[model samples]
Target: MKNPETFPHPIGLMLFNRFEYSQQVLMSLSAQTLPVDQSKLYISIDGYSGSKAELQGKPDSTHAIEELARATFPNATIRRAEKNIGIAEVYFALEVSMLESHPDANWIGFFEEDYVPSPDYLEITSQLASAAQPIDDIAVVAATGETLDPDNRDVQGIFPIGHLWAYLVRVAHVRERRDDLEVFRQQMSGRPYWDRDKIALALVMASRGVFPIGVANDYQRLSLMFRFNRIGVTTGLSYGEYIGVEGEHMTEKSFARFKFSAPTTVPFDIATVDFSASISTLRDQYRADFAKSLAEQYVIPKIRAFTAQKSFKSLPRRRRVASLLGQAFRALF
Candidate 1:
C-alpha cells in the first residue's frame, strides 16, 4: 500500500508555565503567514502563581486560562494539571498525551513557553518533513539558533546545532520510545538533576541514531542550560561525589549563586560569536568567568592530585568500565 499523504499541519506545540513567555509564543504563532487552522495548538498549564489581583475574576488557574481562551484564541485546547509536576514530568506527560491524541500525525512539534517561532517556522518544518520521504531512523528536525559554518550548512542537509527549545519530531519515533522515558526518569529520579526534558529526549533519540534536522536561518531558540545547572547542582549539594565513590568530587568552589534575567532576548542575526553561538556577549563572558573560577578554585588542583595518585588509579577499574559502557549505550544506539 502507498504511504498516506503527510498533513501540512503535522506539528503540535506543547506549552506550559511562563505565562508571559507563552503569550509571546502564541502571538508569534498567530502572526505566522500560513493558515493557522491547518495546525493545532495544545497548552498544558501546571499552575498559576502570581498576583491574584492581576487575574480576571480572581479565579483559579484553569478559570484564568479559560478566560484567556475566551479573550485570546478560544479554539486552542488547554490542558491543566491539578498538582505541580516539575518541568521534566510535565513535558513528558504532555508529549505522551499529544502522541495518543494524534496517532496519525507524522510529526509533533515541541516549543517551550519562551520560544518565539519565526515567520516560516511551521512552513519550513512541514515542507522539510514532507519532502524528506522514506524517513528512516530520523526522528527530529529542528532550528539550530547557532548558525552553521558556511561550508557545513549545506553538507548532509543541515545539522541541528543545539538548543532544542523548538523542534519538530516524528510521532512514531516518539511513541515507540514512550516506555523508555519512564525508565530514564526512574534512572535520573534520585539524582535530583533538572534541565530541558527535550534534551534528555534528544539524547535518547540520538542514541538510536535518529538525526535532528537543521534548517539554516529558520528560527532562534534560547538555551536554558545554565539556569538548570544553578538550580540542580549549585543549591542542592554542598560537597558530593559523582560517578560512584571513586569518581570526581564536587566542592564548594564548583558551584555558586548566580542571578539570571527572565524573558531574555535572542538576536536574529549572529554575525559575531564564539563557536558556541551564545546570543549575549555578556552572558558568554559571565559563563567563561564562572568556568575559570570553578577550574581554579575547585576542579583543577583536586583533579590534578587525584589523577597523580597511582593508588587511586589502581582501584577497581571494572565498575568504571561498566559505567562508561552503559553511558555510551544510552547515548548511542
Candidate 2:
C-alpha cells in the first residue's frame, strides 16, 4: 500500500516544434484514471521564442494549449525555452531541472509530443510500477500497445528506444543517476549516438542489472501498427500500415499521424501470415534466384578480364598523387 501523497509521480511532456499535437497529448493526460493531485504534469515547450514573429506564428496553437491548462489543469506547469535547444540538451536539462525542483515526487514519467495514452494509461502504469519485481533496475512498462511486428516472435519485455516516449522512472533512481549522466553525455557528444539516447541509457541500465518489467495485459488498447516519419524514427507511425473498416481512409487525417501506434482494426490473418516460416522461405528463394541471376548476368570470363585490367589498381595511386600535389600547392601558396 503506497501513500498517495508521498509516492506522487509527476509527468513531464516534451514538446519540440509541433504545437497542435500537444493539445491531444494533454487531453489524453487529463483523461488518466490515476489521481491527478499526486500527478503534476509539466509541458516544456522547447525552442520557444517570444518575438512577435514567433508569437504570431503560434497564436492559435499556444492559446488553446494555455487555456486548456489554465481552465482545467492548473497544476500542469508549462516551461517555454527562450532559445531553441536540440532534443538531447532539452531531455537532459528537463531531467535535471524537474528532479531538482520536485525532490519529493516519487516517480516521473517522460513523454514525447505524439504519445496519446489510453484512459487507464497512468493508473495501470502506476500499479505495474508499484508491483514490479526486481527492484535493483529501472522499471518501464511498455505503453505503446502496438509493436513492430505481431508475428515477429523475437521480442523482449524491454522495447526499442524510440518507443520510450511513455516511460516512468522512480524519482530517487533518476536523482541517484543524475551525477552519472555526464558519462552518457560525453559518450554521445561528437558522434552519431544523439538519437538513440533512450536506447543507450536503457542498455546501460540493463548492463548494470536494471531490468524492465513487462505488462502485456494493460497494453491491450494500444495500436498494432507503428508510425515512422512522424517523430523522425524508423519505427511506429512511420510504418504506414493500417487496419480496421476505415483503416486506409484514416491515414489521410493529420491527427492519426500524431498516434504513432494504432491497433489493427481487422483481425490478423494467421493462416497466411506465418512470419517465421515466411521469412526463412523468402530468404532461401531470394538467395537462389539472386545467385542464378548473378551467374547469368556476370560471366566469370568477363569478370576475370575486368579484374586483370590495371584500371582499378591505378585509381588509388592516382588519388594519393592528387592529394600530395594539392598539399604541395597549398604549401607553396
Candidate 3:
C-alpha cells in the first residue's frame, strides 16, 4: 500500500486579485513531487468588484492574475467571472469549472491563492484523502494538518478542518448532495470572504441550540467541511503552509494576533510512512467527546439561559414545555 505513482484528479485553484500570492502558489503547485501536469488544471477567478478592490487596497488586477495563471499552467481551463461574485460564490464557480465540467472524474484537487503546498503534498494529501474516502463522515482531506509536529502523533487523523489550505474533495460525495451543497453555498454567499470562513462550524451548532464554550465560532467555506456530522480528515503533521496573512481576513497590524507561521523554505518529505493505516477506529472516540462536550458545555448552558427568560415563569407549566426549547434554537439572525 505505497502511495500512487501519479496524482489522479483534476485540480482547481481558486483566486481573485492576489497576483503576488497566486504566483507563489502556482509555482509551488507546478513543482509537486507528483507530476500534476497530467491532471486537468482549472483556475477560477472572481470578477472585479469595487468593494473587494477597496478591501484589498488595490484595483482588481484580475486580468493580470489570469495571465499569470495561464503562464504558469499552460493548459489550464481558466474561468473568470463576468461580474464580481463574492468569495463564497467563487467556490461554487470553481466546483462547476472542475467537477461539473469533468463528470467522469471521481475526486478533484483544490487550492486557494495563499496556500503553498509542500513538494510532497500531492502524494501525502491524496493518500490521506483515500484513507478518508471510505468513511462517510469525513468531508475533505487537507495537506496542512499539524503546524507544529508532535512526537509519534504525525500521522493523518480526523481533526477539525483547521484551514483548507491545500486539499482534495470527492466529486461523488458532493454531487450526491448537490441540492444540499447549493443551499449551503447560497446561505453564506452574501457574506464577506472572512466571515464565511469562520461561520461554518458555528452555523450547524447554532441551528441546534448549541454554541462553543469560550471558543470562537467560525467553521469555513473551505471549512464547509462542517455540516454537523462531517469533519475534516487530514495528516496530523502539517503538509503545507498558509501564507495569506493580509488578504481577505487579516491585516499586517493584526497578523501577529493570530499566531501565523512565517512562510517556510524548508522541504517536507514522506519517507517510510505507513500507507495502510486507517483512522476509522478513532471516529467513535471523537464523536463521543463531542457528545460529552455538547451535553456539558453547549447544551446545558442554553438550558440554563432558557430557564432565565421571564417567559419561563410567565407561562403556565404546560405551555413552557415545548416553546421554551424552540426559542433557544430559533434562528434570530
Candidate 4:
C-alpha cells in the first residue's frame, strides 16, 4: 500500500477569473489529510479574455490569484499566461510541459477552480491511482462519483464517463495519447459549445479505449454513453462536489444543480472495486436522449442555415421548393 503521507505525484489546479471559487478549492486542499507538499501544487491561471470594455473597466483577477497562491502555497510554481489562450489550450500546454519536465511522475491530479474537494479527496484519488497504476485499461481515477438517486447520495458507482472536475490520471497514458488529444483540441477550438473541452477529451479517451474508473454522475454518463461498454463507481463512499454554478462557460440561468456530500470516513480498498454489469439499459436510454440532443445541437440549425443560403434562395422557384422538400425528408428520416 502506498503511504498516504508520501504521495509523490504533483497536482495542477486550473484557475481563471473566479477568485472566490479558486479560494474555496484551495481551502479544501489545505484540509486534506494527505501531506501535499507546497512544491507539488502547480497553479495555472489563465489570462483575461473578456471584452475590451470589461478588461479596461475592471482589474484583472489574475493579480488576486497570484497573491493568493503566493500566500497560501508559497512554494508552489505559478504559471500566468500573458494573453488568453483559452482553457483547452492552457491545459494542453500545461500537460505537455509537465510531461517533459517530470519524466519520473507516474500520475498527476487536476482540479478545476470551482470544485471543492472533501478532506479525503486527495487521499482517495491517490489510493485509486496507485491501485490502478498496473491496470492497462484504466486511464483516469476520478473523485466525482455518480449518485444514482438525487435524494440519496449513498448510491454511487464507477461511471463510464469520469468528470474532470477533480481527478488523477496516469501521466504516461496521457502522454502516449497526446496526438489524439491534439486532434480533439483542434476540433473543439473550431466548435462553439459550452463544454467543448470536456467533450473533446471524453471522445478522444473513448476512441483510445481508455475508460475512467469512478462514480459516474448524470452529465458524465450522458456524455459517455455508446462510447464504452460498462461503467461503475465505489459502492460506499462519495468524494466531492461540483460547485461551479457560474463561470465563463455557464450562466446563472444555465447552471446545473449538483448534490454535495461529505467524504467517506470508513476505510475502503479501491483494489476490490469492480464494474462487470452490462450497461444496455442505460445505454438505450442514453442513445435516445443523445439523438434528440444531436438534432437540436447540430442538425436543425444546419438545415436552417442551408435554407437561408443565398445560392439556395437564388435558385429557380421549382428548385428551391425541391430543396426544401429534400431538407424536410432528411430531417424526418
| Number of the top TM-score candidate | 3
Pairs that clash in candidate 4: 145-215, 146-215, 146-216, 157-232, 157-233, 158-232, 158-233
TM-score of each: 0.50, 0.49, 0.69, 0.66
- Give the worst 10-residue stretch by lDDT in candidate 2: 223-232
Off by over 4 Å in 2: 1-7, 49-64, 104-106, 146-162, 172-180, 183-260, 263-333
lDDT at 150, model 1 = 22
lDDT (CA) per prediction = 0.43, 0.45, 0.62, 0.60
Off by over 4 Å in 1: 1-7, 10-12, 48-66, 146-157, 187-333
Query: Candidate 3 regions off by >4 Å?
Result: 1-6, 55-57, 146-160, 188-228, 261-281, 285-333
Q: Quote the positional error of residue 266 for candidate 4 in Å.
A: 6.4
Instruction: Give the TM-score (vs. native) of candidate 4.
Output: 0.66
Candidate 2 residues 1-333, lDDT tens each?
323432246677776545556666666666655555523666676654532324446443444455655555676677766654445555677676667778776667777656666555566456535543234232343345433232221222222222344666556555554443554455455532223355555455335433222111111101111110011011122111222112112234653554434532332121332223333443343334333433433344354554466764456877756754554444322
Show model 4 residue runs off by greater than 4 Å: 1-4, 49-59, 146-154, 187-237, 256-333
lDDT of 1 at 283: 40
Model 4 / residue 301 / CA error / Å: 13
**How many clashes does the backbone of model 4 have?**
7
Query: How close is each model in CA RMSD to the real structure?
Result: 14.3, 14.3, 6.8, 8.2
Show the colliding residue pairs in model 1: 141-213, 207-333
lDDT of predicted model 3: 0.62
lDDT of 1 by residue, 244-321 (tens): 111012223442221111221332221321222322433444345434533454455555565567765675888546
